[model samples]
Target: MIRLLIADDSALMRKLLEGIFTAEGDFDIRTARNGNEALELVRAFDPQVVTLDVQMPGMDGLTCLSRIMIEAPRPVVMISSLTAEGAEATLEAIELGAVDFIAKPGGAVSLEIDRLRPLLVEKVRAASGARIRRTLRLTERVRHQIRGAGLASRPRPSRVSPSPVAKIGKVGMKPGSATLPGLVLIGTSTGGPAALDIVLPQLPADFPWPILVAQHLPASFTGPFAKRLNRECDLDVVEVNRPMPLKPGTIYIGKGDADVMVAPRAAGVIAMPVPAKGSYLWHPSVERMVASALDHLEASHLVGVMMTGMGNDGAEAMKRLRLTGGRTIAEAESSAIVWGMPGELVKNGGAEAVRPLEDIAETIIEMVNSCAAN
Candidate 1:
């Protein structure tokens, strides 16, 4: 049975969550009306997982998450509103040690609660087994990476700070720059954002290839995440909300609720956002993105890097990439928040190299240089 705690300022919400979990029959449940109460119960109730609301009277959710990480580290799933402010705060909670977040539809309560129920339950269940200490190490890793890239700030060791590289100016790519030596395709979910922080900031601004990412996220959250990445990484990052010309040194993040694909255009290859395909299970679908890239570019001119995520979204497409001469890398199990996706690649003989999160950037740089040399 899973021991769980639900913390919110709303009595109705607390009761609502309790009922939802109770129906599952295997959850041992507790509730708190505010952060203060939640803090006390964390020690007393000793839950395997926690559901924390972003808004609470007296102390906010981010403050509570900070204390929880320092005092008794465990997996936490944040419940947030689907507004812009809520997305920003939710990302902060992720850096502060919350394993994942589930956005509350229609503000704190809504008719959409029924639709969100399964997602909320699944995330909480996933959080129950997450590695809290891995998150701490990741926080440290990103800080060290930023400092090496000349963008360091001394934030707390366990905290994911606001854009450590925000002061670094972005470099514009010359249109029609020499054929992209290669394009890097990264796919992740679950612990992806923090994992990205460790890798993207490590690459220099003039790095040869453009990067495309397919991270599973909701529509409301992806825009904020892309903006956050733009500030934190030296590479120019933008959400692919429209057809954008592929540019070297830029990172294209697929817009949430839609898929991003690369295809040939009269001017050049453009990365464009398209409606999610019905066949794929996850949106900003990794499978579709890699398949699309292969349809237009040589497999040898592509590199697939699979990072921390919960399912095998990119495994098959990338397997095709490697079999056809493309280079592939999987995040070593040691550093993955969830090994499901990368593990699938490893099992299926897709990855040419399986590297830890810390080594992936260097591996990418080396592979890109080799691809260019060829």
Candidate 2:
């Protein structure tokens, strides 16, 4: 049986969630009325996975999450609303150690809750078996160091050294070429936002290539997430809504509920969002986006990165990129929140180099600059 806990201030919401999980069977359900009660139950129930509401009374979701990470340290999926504040909190919670999030549909007693049944069930199942990091040892200084200058109030020197597994190899590009490949494609999920926060801010403001990112999130959350990233990153970050020319020193984030695709236009390669089909497991699928870019751009012109995420959505596509002479980097297991995505890539012989999260930006910078210099 899957040991599960649901924490919400609304009794109706808690009951509704309980019914959903119970209907799935093999689930031992426990409920908590608020954050304080949730903490108590966490100690007593010892559930494999927990679903926490962001706006609970008596400690609230964020406080409860911090406490949970500090105390019990289990996989947690946050229940968030579609509002901007909810999106911000959800991102913060993920950084704090939550595995994923489910957007609350409608209100506390919303009948629209049915719309979230599929997502909730899937996320809960994933969280149940997730590998969570130990946050108990992260002091304020350690956190600032791990997350880089992006999340902290004070400025610090960025580290850009290569990891033990990083391969500093030669790019097979000729010198003095007018048209060189200058597109960076990054795909991540599960624990992607936190990884992005670390990497995006490390790139210099004059980075020559345009970056396209596909992260699994809700449509309402992507914009706010991009804004958060923009505040810390030296490059301009925006949520891509329509077909726009790719620009240097800018990062384009795909819409949460859509698949990001690239096409060659007269101006340049432009990114746009396509509505996700029902068959797709990952919204804004990393595989679909990278594959689209591969169709139009040469492998040498692109740098493909697979970060901390679940499943192998982009692994096969990354393998193809490597075969065609593209530079590929997979996030090392040591730094991954979940190593599924990058692990699959390495298993399939898709990656050229695998580096820890802290070294990824430095490796990318070095690779891009080398290509430009050659």
TM-score of every candidate: 0.88, 0.86
- In model 2, residue pairs whose N, Cα or C atoms come closer than 3 Å (at least 3 residues apart or on different chains), thus clashing, are 181-301
lDDT of 1 by residue, 186-220 (tens): 99988888788678877777776789999998787
Candidate 2 lDDT, 198-287, residue by residue in tens: 788888776778899999888988998999888888799999888777777799999998889987665556789889967668978888
**Model 1: lDDT to the true structure:** 0.82
Error of 1 at 268 (Å): 1.0
C-alpha positional error of residue 350 in candidate 1 after TM-score superposition, expressed in Å: 1.4
Model 2 regions lying over 4 Å from their true place:
107-111, 134-180
After superposition on all C-alphas, the RMSD of every candidate to the true structure, in Å, is: 6.1, 4.8
The number of the candidate with the highest TM-score is 1
